[model samples]
Target: VAARSPEPVTPSLSFPQRREKIERRQQEVENELKMWDPHNDPNAQGDAFKTLFVARVNYDTTESKLRREFEVYGPIKRIYMVYSKRSGKPRGYAFIEYEHERDMHSAYKHADGKKIDGRRVLVDVERGRTVKGWRPRRLGGGLGGTRRGGADVNIRHSGRDDTSRYDER
Candidate 1:
């Protein structure tokens, strides 16, 4: 058999460029780590708390008061009443951090449907903010035109009567 020449290997990138790429990768990993629940890991054994978001809260409710109310159900580590960055006032919602999974469950159980100043609050895990990728197209004619004046917009989801609202039987 004839001997074949070896293929040439590509040169390694420069140290500075390689290090920069590594740093960027590390930062991405750190951001992803922030999204994970520590309690979800079976190997994780610590006093760290799980965070929950409560929406539809009274705008006047303070963080301390929110925490105190949830403390009756479980050990609350902290409460952050979300506020509008522009207005510098409460945004009618809050995020709660509890010290244990049991506390998180208890808070969700008892806190939901509980009225706070006549407004029932809804609580759940604090999911990452979803980016609005698209806006829905407006129906009917432009601002000045009436809805009926525009082209017909038929919704055939159920295949029912097309115009029954106006049936004068």
Candidate 2:
């Protein structure tokens, strides 16, 4: 007697059914995009107007120029221009601290998306420290270790053998 092989299972949807499924998925994505708001993030809820992160700043932008521009809104507590460690040049970004929250909010509303020195600048409330989480990575290329504080592991050898080739002296 000959044995019969089982046929592979395939999706039984018709052409019309497949097209309807794709159209439904596309509509869901469009709805999600329409409902999304960048400024309504939960992390930016409390005391987010105290500090502002400015990006795409002109390289020739000076501290005095930044101060003069922002001073029109309110008093500034401090301005820190990020610099490259190797080149010792401005990194085209900075952190602006306001003495009052109202000033910070005013600066954020006015300066964001504004052009300075012909470069459009991006201004937003500074984000807090990122939450630590387990990030999975591919094994190999000298990256085969577990996360910290979990447990001690030896990846070089298996634990099946009890004896070593060398004697303990």
Candidate 3:
């Protein structure tokens, strides 16, 4: 006599349950896209226009190299590669200037989350003031031209001696 194997029974998942699972997966993807997508970002282009200061760059990277690499995505106005002040070595970061807001939109869209020299590059607008050749004015003659908090005293120099005339007067 041939013995029939018992049929395996499985509980069926509900439609809403399956839909919820799909929705959760979709939400995760949406979140990831939102985090990295520069095009959809409202802050990408504003009154300031999109600009980015890149950091953690390779020591050998040059401005022209970075510009050429990034120009494939969009038109670059300027690229300033940061160098160490003391050591004069590349700081592994650069500032990228875009001509148009749309250019930035495209550059950032493709630049973010992208690896350069085995490291990821960050893109953001430049909001800081770039001051160059800053020189502070010399404040000579302390506080309104008075010496040691005393009233303005005039010193008169005579040919022979001013001290003798002062004592006699």
Candidate 4:
């Protein structure tokens, strides 16, 4: 009887194939890291803060006053003071847009917690668009309910009463 020869075993992956797979995995990890990087994040971009939200603004604060205060940091593109439609007065908040992000950042860093018109104001980067259909909430529950300052009366007499309270005197 002739001795049987063993067959050679094949490797699951060639050296080149393993190297390519490793490179691909490394690239995927790099891409994921880049996505999480603050510098690469869209919201962290240099122009992300070109617009700023200034809160606690004096109701009488004017756009010109805001421009003057912020202009020291950079050129002002626009200034918008939120106003109440009923009273037609400033709503205690405003948005300021700067010509450059550098100025906006400067203003945000320096003006935050600073006094404007004798009131401390908050400066922050404007985030996203304002929500639509949002309404100001009433101090207490909504109007017209007994819980909200509405009067509650209990009638002492029924309609079928024979007392004739409405009879002519």
* Highest lDDT scorer: 2
The residue-by-residue lDDT of candidate 1 on 1-86, one tens digit each, is 99999999999989998999988877866665555443375433333236666888988777777877788877877776767889
RMSD of each: 20.6, 23.3, 28.9, 27.0
- Ranking, lDDT, top scorer first: 2, 4, 1, 3
TM-score of 3: 0.44
Model 2 TM-score, all chains together: 0.48
Could you tell me the lDDT of residue 8 within candidate 2? Answer: 86
lDDT for predicted candidate 4 compared with the true structure: 0.63
**Cα lDDT tens digits for candidate 3, 83-121:** 678998887777787777677656755676566767777
Error in Å for residue 163 of model 4: 80
lDDT of 2 at 132: 19
Query: Model 2 segments beyond 4 Å from truth?
Result: 1-49, 129-169
- Candidate 1 structure lDDT: 0.59
Ten contiguous residues minimizing lDDT sum, candidate 3: 134-143
Query: 13-122 in candidate 2: lDDT tens per residue?
Result: 99999999989877876666566443575533334447777889999999888888778888888888888989999989887888887777677668887888889887
Question: Relative to the true structure, how large is the alpha-carbon lDDT of every model?
Answer: 0.59, 0.64, 0.56, 0.63
**Model 4 compared with the native: what TM-score?**
0.48
Clashing pairs in model 3, backbone N/Cα/C closer than 3 A: 57-92
- The residue pairs that clash in candidate 1, if any, are none
TM-score of each predicted structure versus truth: 0.47, 0.48, 0.44, 0.48
Report the Cα lDDT for residue 133, model 1. 22
Sorting all predicted structures by TM-score, with the top scorer first, yields: 2, 4, 1, 3
Judged by lDDT against the true structure, how good is candidate 3?
0.56
Question: 1 or 4, which is superior by TM-score?
Answer: 4
